[model samples]
Structures are given as C-alpha cells and as structure tokens.
Target: MHKKQKGEAAVITLVIVMILVMVGGLFFGLPLWNRWRAGIGGEAELRQAEFNRQIATLEAKQELESAEYLNQAEVLRARGVAEANRIVADGLGGPDGYLRYLWIQGLSKGSTPQVIYIPTEAGLPVLEAGKR
Candidate 1:
C-alpha cells in the first residue's frame, strides 16, 4: 500500500508539471511571436519609405536636368538675337525672365525645375516691357 501511494503521488506531480509548462507557454510564447511579427512589419515600412525617398530624388534630378536644358536653349536664342540686333534688350522681358516664368509654371504643375530662382538685389526682378 505504501509503494502504490508513492507511485500515484509521482504521477500527479508529473501531470502538474506538464500542465504548468503548457500554461507558461501559452502566456509567454504568443507574445514573443507577436513581437517578432511587429518587428518584421516595421522593417518593411522602413524599406518602403527609403524606396519612396529614392524615387522622389530621382524625379527631382530629372526635373533639374530639364530646367538646365531649357536655360541653355534660352541663352543660345538670346545670343542669336544679340548678334542680329546689335543691342542687348533691357528689362525682365528678356530670356531669363521668360525662363523663370516657364519654370514657375512647370513647378506649379508639380514639375521640379533645376534653376529654382533667378537672383536679384532685393528679390526676384519684376517683369516689365521696358526697364533697366
């Protein structure tokens, strides 16, 4: 009878240990799994943000190149006019003003331009028909 009682107590202890282990796992393991999933999601969001920044930079560069090309074309046209007329026209109605106007228009349409601004003494020079 003493030996049988000892065996039964041992079995009960084993069963209690097993149940405790399962309960501990239920409490701890699930949270760890959830944390790992959240970490993965955060990493993916960071990667996506980086990709978006790169794309925006590429787009800005392209727009700058376009603006530079347009500026060069305007300079060439001005040179041609100067050679033909023998008098440099005065005022913001010249090539630079026209280019700035065009750039502003493009920017308004969501196109970034390389030459962001034309510098003047106080601020941007006002466009006029005839002025120095």
Candidate 2:
C-alpha cells in the first residue's frame, strides 16, 4: 500500500508541474506577443505618415517651379507684344507670323493661364523711342 501511495503522489506532482508550466507560458507569452504586434503597427503608421509628407513636399515644389515658369513666360509675352507692335509700325511686314502674341495657358489641370510671346527680331525687345 505504501508503494501505491508513493506512485499516486508522483503522478500528482507531475500534473501540478504541467499546470504550472502552462500557466507560466500564458502569463509571459501573451504580453510579449501583444507588444510585438503593437510595435509593428506603430512602425507601419510612421512609415505611412512619412511617405505622405514626402509626397506633399514634392507636390509643393512642383507647384513652385510651375509658378516660376509662368511668371517668366508672362515677362516674355510682354516683351513679345511690344516687339510685335514696334515691328508693325516700322514697316517690317506688319509683325511676322512668328512674332505674333502667343501663349500657352493652363499647364496643370487646376493651374491658371500661362502666357508666352516670341519676338521676330534677333535681339531682345527695345523700349519705345522716348519712353525709357
């Protein structure tokens, strides 16, 4: 009977050990897994936010370049128009076809008009004789 009792005691001890192992695993593993998942989620969100900022910056730069180009084109147009009128008055065949005031408006879908002008003469446009 003592042998049988000892055997039962050993079996009970094994069961308690297994239960403790399972409980310990549950206590430690879950929090670690949850922390890893949260870290991954945070990293993904940070990457997405960074990408959005880069895109916005690129878009803004493109807009600024486009505006600069438009302003330059406006200056060219003003010069071309003056040159055309001058040539027309100077008996130069009434301003060549290439000297006509021309413009390309609306480069982007939402952009404003862009005007451009090309003069007929080789040199830059000259101011009116006495107008400075």
Candidate 3:
C-alpha cells in the first residue's frame, strides 16, 4: 500500500510540472509569433512594390514627356505673340504712339462724346462735387 501511494504521488507531481511548462511557454511565445506574422506581411508588401516598379517608371516617363511637349507649345505661342507686338510697334512708331492712336480712335467712335477735363494745380478735377 505504501509503494502504491508513492507511485501515485510521483504521477501527480509530473502532471503539475508539465502543465506549468506549457503555460510558461505560451506566455513567452505569443510575442515572437506576432513578430513573425508581421515580418511575413512586410515581405508581401515588398513583393507588391517590386511587381509595380516597371509600371511606375513608365507612368513617370509619360508625364515628363507630356510636360516637355506642353512647354514647347507654350514657347511657340509666346514667340508668335512677341512677333505680332513687334510688328505693331514698328508700324505705329512705338508703344506710346500706338496708345495715343487708340485714344483718338476711341474718341471718334463713341456717340456720347466724352469730355476731357484738365486737373488744376492742386491735382483735383476742375469741378468739385458740392460746388455750385
């Protein structure tokens, strides 16, 4: 009877130690498992980036080509405008002469006949608003 009781006691002690080992392992291993999962996710993202690299490069190239074409078109337009201005300036004698020509043309066309009033020495118009 004594020997049987000793065997039973030994079995109970072994079971308790096994349970403690399993619990301790679970406590320490969870963080390591999560870290490994995150590493796998990062690797997947890297693979996706690698897959799209050629497409990204082609898109950038297309954008740069389009910008260059547009810039050239704008330069051509500006050159045309400048040439027209130069021709008009030469025909009119200068920019100031062109402006005076425009003023006279405006005066001739309008029916109401705009009045030109010279400013006095005080830099005010000839007629003040409240003066009789």
Candidate 4:
C-alpha cells in the first residue's frame, strides 16, 4: 500500500510539470510569431513606397517632355510670324508704300470714309463722295 501511494504521487507530479512546460512554451513563442508577421508587413510597405516613387518620377519625366514640346512649338510659331512680317515689309517699299497699300485696301471695301485725309508734303485733306 505505501509503494502504491508513492507511485501515484510521482505520476501526478510528472503530469503537472508537462502542463507547465507547454504553457511556458506558448507564452515565449507568441511574441516571436508576432515579430515575424510585423517584419513581413514592413517589407511589403517598403516595396509599395518604392513603387510609388518610381511612378512619380515617370510622371515628372513625361510632364517635362510635354513642356519642352510646347515651348518648341511656341518658338516655331513666333519665328513664322516674324518671317511673314519681314516678307510683307520687303514687298512694301517704305512707310508711304504701306500707307498706299492700306488706301487701296480701304477702296476695295464696300464702305468708304466720309472725310479722308491724305498725307502729302503740306498735309492736305481729301474729300470722299460729297464734302462741303
């Protein structure tokens, strides 16, 4: 009877020890698992940040190219206008020639001015249609 009681007490102590070891292992392993999951999430966030930066750089490059093209087009348009003005100036002999061209252009129109002043050496006035 004494030996049987000793055996039963030994078995109970071993079972309790096993339960305590299992609880301690779980307590220690939970933090390590949480840290590993956080590391994975952090790595994913870093990759997303890099992707966003690359997209921003690409957009800036495209915008710069568009601006350069617009500037070139504006310069070309201005040069064309300057060239046209030079050709017109060459066709008209001088200031008086340009004035004569304007007079001819006005005459070609249907409407005429009632009082017209023609520039001469003395600045004389020319009457249109009927003038008193």
Candidate 5:
C-alpha cells in the first residue's frame, strides 16, 4: 500500500535522528568525563597529604615516648652504678677512693714523665723589644 511506504520512510527518519543525537551526546560528554577524572586525581593527592600528616604526628608521638623511656632507663642505670660504687667504697674504706690517682698513673705507663714550670703572675707585653 502507498500509506505503508510513507510510514516506513518516517520511521527511517526517526531512527536516523536518534542515531545523530547519540553521536552528538558522545562527543559533548567526553570533556565532562575528562574533567571528572582530573578532579579525582586532585582528591587523591589531598587524601595522601592528610594521611602523611597523620602519620608524621603519630611518629613524633612515638619518638617522644621512646625518648622518655630511654631517659628513665639511663637514670636507673646511673643510680645503680652510684649505689655499687658506694658499696665498694664502704668495703674498701679509703683504698677505693684513689681511682683518680690510678687513672693518672695509667696515663704515664711505659713513657717518660715530663715536668714543666708555669709562671705565677702574668706580665705585660714588651713595648720596646729590640729587633734584629
């Protein structure tokens, strides 16, 4: 029938228009998608910086706690050493107190001893010393 052919032509035109619209949308939407992808990169960088800041803060706290514990251990060590020295001094009475003398003697071992004289008073610089 002649009417049927005209209806088929209209349907063909409608299909063509729909395809053109879809192509236009594909072209126009490309830049929008690119912008969204660029924004995601910026958000990722911001999140990474926030995580780094948090990690640094936690590390600093840990370092401070470690330093505090180290100082406490050092204090305990010094106290123990002093107590042991006191006990040894009590056992030896006056003999254990000569450690300084022993250390000075150790420095002079297997070497000749030297003596030097020092002036008791400082003199003024010579103003008219003769020069050759």
Candidate 6:
C-alpha cells in the first residue's frame, strides 16, 4: 500500500508541473504572436500601395501619349490650311486680285440691301452717279 501511494503522488506532481509550464509560455509568447500578425498586415499594405503607384504612372503615360497625338493632328491640319491658302493666292494672281474676287462674291450673294457706288481713279466712290 505504501509503494502505491508514492507512485500516485509522483503522477500528481508531474501534472501540476505541466500546467505551470503552459501558463508561463502563455505569459511570454502572446506578445510575439501579436507582433508576427502585425508584420503580415504591414506587408499587405505595402503591396497595395505599390500597385496604386503603378496604376498612376500608367495613367500619366497614357495622357502624355494622347496629347502628343492631338498635337500631331493639329500640325497636319495647319499645314493643309496653309497649302490651300497658297494655291488660292496663286490662282487669283495676287492679294489685290483676291480682294476683287471677294468683293464680287459678296455682291453675288445679295442676302441684304446694299448701296452701290462706283470707285474713281482717285479711289473715291461716286455716290451721286445714281441721281444722274
């Protein structure tokens, strides 16, 4: 009976020691576990920020390319207008001839009433010609 009591006492002592070890580990390891979780969260945030920056850079590049294309189109349009003006000038013979052509065109439209006056050699309009 005495030997059996001793074995029982040893088993009880072993169980109490295991409980104490578990408690001590909880007191020390909780902070380390929290820190590890925080590191994971921070890495995720960094990855998201990098992705946003890449998107912004790509958007800016696309805007610059669009502006370049618009500028090229404007340059081409301006060149075509200048060439058309040069051809018209050559066909009319000179600036004076172009002006005379414009005057004749305005008279042909006749969208409104206008006073008719014939110009003299001195470049003065003969306003009294209709009365004679």
Ranking by lDDT: 6, 3, 4, 1, 5, 2
Global local distance difference test of model 6 = 0.90
Q: What lDDT does model 3 reach?
A: 0.88
The candidate that wins on lDDT is 6
Candidate 3 vs candidate 6, TM-score winner: 6
lDDT of 2 by residue, 77-124 (tens): 999988867775466444453243321113344365434343548766
What tens digits encode model 6's per-residue C-alpha lDDT throughout 1-132?
999999999999999999899888888888888899999999999999999999999999999999999999999999998888778767999778777887898999989978878889999998976667
Residue-level lDDT tens digits of model 1 in 1-132: 999999999999999999999999989999999999999999999999999999999999999999999999999999997764433223446667656665666788875434334457988764642444
Rank by TM-score (best first): 5, 6, 4, 2, 1, 3
lDDT of each: 0.81, 0.77, 0.88, 0.85, 0.80, 0.90
Which parts of model 6 have CA positions greater than 4 angstroms off?
1-23, 99-132
Which tens-of-lDDT digit does each residue in 14-129 have in candidate 5? 99999999999989998899999999999999999999999999999999999999999999999998887777666656545646554556767837654433334575554434
Worst 10 residues of 6 by lDDT: 94-103
User: What is model 6's C-alpha RMSD?
Assistant: 6.1
lDDT of candidate 3 over 66-99, digit per residue (tens): 9999999999999999898778877999998878
Alpha-carbon runs more than 4 Å astray in model 5: 95-132
Residue 119, candidate 1: how far off, in angstroms? 40
**Candidate 5: residue 114 Cα off by (Å):** 27
- Model 2 Cα displacement at 49 (Å)? 0.9
Selected candidate, larger lDDT, 2 vs 4: 4
The TM-score leader among the candidates is 5
Q: Per-residue error at 54 for model 2, in Å? A: 1.1
Which TM-score value belongs to model 5?
A: 0.63
Worst 10 residues of 4 by lDDT: 123-132
Provide C-alpha RMSD values for all models, in order.
16.0, 14.2, 8.0, 6.6, 8.1, 6.1
